[model samples]
Target: MNKKLRKWFRGLTAGKAVHFLLALLWFGLTLFPLYFTVVSSLKLDNEIWDTMFQLPSIPQWENYFKAAETAGILSAIVNSVVISLGSVAIMIVCVMMSSYVIARRLIKRAKALNLYLLAALMIPLQGAIVPIVQMVGAVGGKNNFFVLMLIYVGLNISISSFILVGYIGGISREIDEAAAIDGCNLFQTIFRIIFPISMPGVATAAIVGFLNVYNELPIANVILTKTENRTISVALLAFQGDYQTSLSLIFASIVIVIIPILIFYLLCQEKVEHGLASGAIKG
Candidate 1:
């Protein structure tokens, strides 16, 4: 074992050894928090701090049930899914059409309009909270999922357009000409030709928009006042009290809340990676 270890160590150059050790360090740093959360979730409330780094004597599987029931996690999950998915769907459609128009300069002053939309990226949501609340109240839309979804779509358009416009612009205009030559209308060309070719960008925008709406708390807290309309982020906030907090239950809820994001990422992982790679290279 010693001879093999020495041989292996000798085979690695100094830079490779340094990089390997640094990679291992980064891996451990990234993995430890998740390990801690899982371990803590399986422990008793008292056992959590007492044996912070140790395994629980017996797992507390009941914590998940208790957290889910007490926090209304299941319903919150539904609300989040509805709002996030709805918002992403609307944002994608709007941004895609707008981005295509901007990319192709189809509309007058398209560059000016693109710049105007991209300018929203610099405005923080908090800064506009008062105006948003006033606008929503003026329209008599409160505690409404549709309203919230629309707000999400509006907020996300800037970045989504920025990502997609650049991506769509990278595609050859000759394809559009070809589609035109084949007797396809403008909308038909966009749907059939540009849509498939720009899927990576769309995937990227969808993922970003979904994540933004799903995890957003400030706007949701302000607008989704009803218990039934509470999102997962708001539901998690309910776990905290003035005098008492359950760490184990919070950890369990954390685990539950992350499952959907994991599933979504797994589904869109390929497209997102390709989109990012294409953007980096093209940009």
Candidate 2:
């Protein structure tokens, strides 16, 4: 046992030891917030701040029930899901088609068009929220989820385009030729062949677009003025008030809000990782 321990210690080179320590640190950092939230969510209001780092004496499962009831969590979750999935679906379709066109240089001045679309990246959409709100108001589109979905798609277009274009560009032209020779039309070729081959990129863009739309607050808050139409981010504001706040409830709500997205990320994590790695290499 002593000899084995000595061998194991000797095997830990400086670089390996440093890396292990860093990874351990990162793991702790990543879990700490979740631990804090879980503990705080179970405690009394005063206990949350006072014993923040400690576990609750008695776990208050009622906090979840209270949060769900008070915040309309189910409704908000449903709204977020509908809008997020709808927005990402639309975004993926638009981004993939546009990216393919750009990547294949199929359209006139495709590079110029790509650059023009990408220019939106430099302009912060949040900075122009006044005009956006005005434009939506002018159209009488407030509380309309379809309009919000469109806005989400528009906001995400630039980054999605960048990612998809790079990934699609990396795909070989020979595949297009093969599809053509096999009697596939442009639409068929793109959807059947290119789309599958470039799924990693699509997954990457979808994840990004979903996260953006789901967590969006200012626009959702303004547009979805009705309590019934509110998304999770907007609904969270119910817990916070000017004079007093329910910190425990807020943590409970947070835990509920994060569960779906965490599940989503876990499901798509493999594809997303591949997409990012390939995109980096391709770019």
Candidate 2 accuracy as lDDT: 0.93
Screening candidate 2 with a backbone cut-off below 3 angstroms (N, C-alpha, C), the clashing residue pairs are none
Best by TM-score: 2
lDDT of 2 by residue, 1-283 (tens): 9999899899999999999999999999999999998888898899998887988999999999999999999999999999999999999988888999998999899999889988989997679799999999999999999999999999999989888988999999999999999999998998999999999989999998899899999999999999999999999999999999999999999999999999999999998889977876785
lDDT to native, each model: 0.90, 0.93
Model 1 reaches what TM-score against the true structure? 0.91
Please report how far candidate 1 places residue 231 from its true position, in Å. Answer: 1.0
* lDDT minimum window of 10 residues, candidate 1: 274-283
Candidate 2: minimum summed lDDT over ten consecutive residues — where?
Answer: 274-283
